[model samples]
Target: MKTIVKRSSVFFLICLILLMPISSFAHGMILKLEEPGVLKVEYDGGGFSPRTEITIYDEEGNELGKGPVDEEGKFHFDPGMKVHSAIADDGMGHRAEYKEGVEEKNIPKVPVVIGVFAVIAVIFVLFNKKAKARQQ
Candidate 1:
C-alpha cells in the first residue's frame, strides 16, 4: 500500500510540472515605435494567424500605411507622414495598439557607464590579488 501511494504521488507531481509551462503562456500583442516614422508590431500567445494586419493612421483618421505581419509574428513599417497612432489585428480577435508620443522614462547613461566601470574595477582587483597570492 505504501509503495502504490508513493508511486501515484510521484506521477501526479510529474504531471503538474509538465503542465506548468503551458499555463505560463499569455495571449497578447504589442505595438511600439522603433524610431521616428518607423513602427514595430509583435504578437504573443501562440503563432500568428495568417495575414495578420497592421495599420498606421494620423490624428485626423487618415490612413498612413498598412501591411501584413510575417510568420515570426512581427512587422515593421515606415509611415511617410507623422503618425498619431497605430493598430494591429490578427483577424482572429487578437489585437494591439500604440498611441503616438507615448513617453518612455529616459534612463540616464552616466549611471550605467559608472556601474560597468565599477564592475570591471572589482574584477581587476580580484584578479590582481589572486595573482599576488599565487606568487607568494
Candidate 2:
C-alpha cells in the first residue's frame, strides 16, 4: 500500500546518499615531501588509485625522477639530486604538486616573544603602582 512505497522510497534515498561520496571521491591527489630528498604521495579519494604516476622536478623545471605509486596509493622516492618540487597524477586528470622551500616570514619568533613579555611586565608594574597609590 502507500506505507510500503514510502518506506522503499526512503530506503532508496538513503542508499543514494551513501553512494554519492564514492563517486565524488573519484578524483584528487596530494603530494608531500616531509623529509629532505624523500617524497610521499597520497590520493584524496576513499583509497588510492593503484599505479598512479609521480614525477619530480627541480626549480629549473628539469625532471629529477619519475615512478608509479604502490597499490596502497602511497609512493616514496629518493631523488638522487635535490628536488625543488614534485607532481602527482592519477592518470584521470586528478593531479597535485608541491614546491619545496621555506615560506617567507615577516616577523621572527624570538623578538615577538620578548616583546610580549616586556608588555606584560610593564602592565603588571603599572597596576601595582596604581594599587599602592590607592592604598596611600
Candidate 3:
C-alpha cells in the first residue's frame, strides 16, 4: 500500500508538471504598439476578462506615459518620440511589460518584429517554466 501511494503521488506530480504549463498559458495577454513614436498598445484579457493599464518608458527607465485600457482592452501612447519599454497591467490583477529599443537597427518592421518576437518568446518560455512548477 505504501509503495502504491508513493508511485501514485509521483505520477500525479509528473502529470501536474506537464499540464501546469498549458494552464499557465490558459490566459492570454497581448500587447501591440505600431510605431515607436506613437507607442500604441493593445491588450486582450484572456478569457477571464478584465480592465488593464498600460505604461510606456524610455531608455533611461523613466516613465513616459500610462493609462487604463479601454473597453476593448486597448491603450495608446503618443509620446511623439521613441521609447524603450511598454508595460500593461490588467485592472483585474494582471500585468504585462514589453521592452523596445534593444536593437540598434533602423530597418523595416519585418526584422524588428522578428527580433521582438524572439525576445518575447524567450521571456514567455522562462516564465512558463516557473509558473508551471508553482502550479504543480
Candidate 4:
C-alpha cells in the first residue's frame, strides 16, 4: 500500500513538475530596465529568450521605438527622459510589461535557478524519507 501511494504521488508530482515550464514559457518572459535605455529580455525560468520583440512608449502613449531583441535577448536604445513603459513579447504567447509605476524585478539567473533546484530538493526529501536519513 505504501509503495502504491509513493508511486502515485511521484507520478502526479512529476507530471506537475514537467508542466510548470510549459505553462510558464507562455507567460513568463520579462523585460528589465537595465539602466533606463538598455532592455534585457529573459525567461522567468532563466537564460536568453530567443527572438523577443520589444516596444518602448513615451508618457503620452506614443511609441518611441519598436524592434526585435537580439540573440542575447537584449535591446539597446536611448529614448531619453520621456520613457513611460516598455513591452516584451516572444510572439509565442510569452509577454511582459514594464510600466512607470510598476517595476518588474530583474531576477538574477543563478539565484533563481538555485532556488528552483532547492524547491525540487525539498520536494524530493518530502517524498523520500529514507533519502534524508542517509548521510555521507
| Best-fitting candidate, scored by lDDT | 4
RMSD of each: 14.1, 18.9, 12.0, 6.8
**Taking the tens digit of each residue's C-alpha lDDT, what string does model 2 give over 1-136?**
5565556556655664564435332445667775665556665445666767888887899997888877655556664677887788877877878887743233444575567557656865665566556556
If ranked by TM-score, best first, what sequence of candidates would result? 4, 2, 3, 1
TM-scores, in order shown?
0.47, 0.48, 0.47, 0.56
Model 4, C-alpha of 102: deviation from truth (Å): 1.8
Q: What lDDT is reached at residue 59 by model 4?
A: 85
Candidate 3 residue runs with Cα over 4 Å from true position: 1-22, 36-50, 101-136
User: Which order, best to worst by lDDT?
Assistant: 4, 1, 2, 3
Tens-digit lDDT string for candidate 4 (1-136): 5666668667857875876564322336777787767888887767765678899898889999989988778888874756788888888777888887786666555676678778877876675665334421
Poorest lDDT segment (10 consecutive residues) of candidate 3: 39-48
lDDT of 4 at 65: 90
Local distance difference test, candidate 4: 0.74
Error of 4 at 61 (Å): 1.2
Question: Residue 40 CA error for candidate 2 (Å)?
Answer: 2.3
- Global lDDT of each model? 0.66, 0.66, 0.58, 0.74
Candidate 1, TM-score vs. the true structure? 0.47
Q: List the residue pairs that clash in candidate 4.
A: none
Colliding residue pairs in candidate 3: 51-91
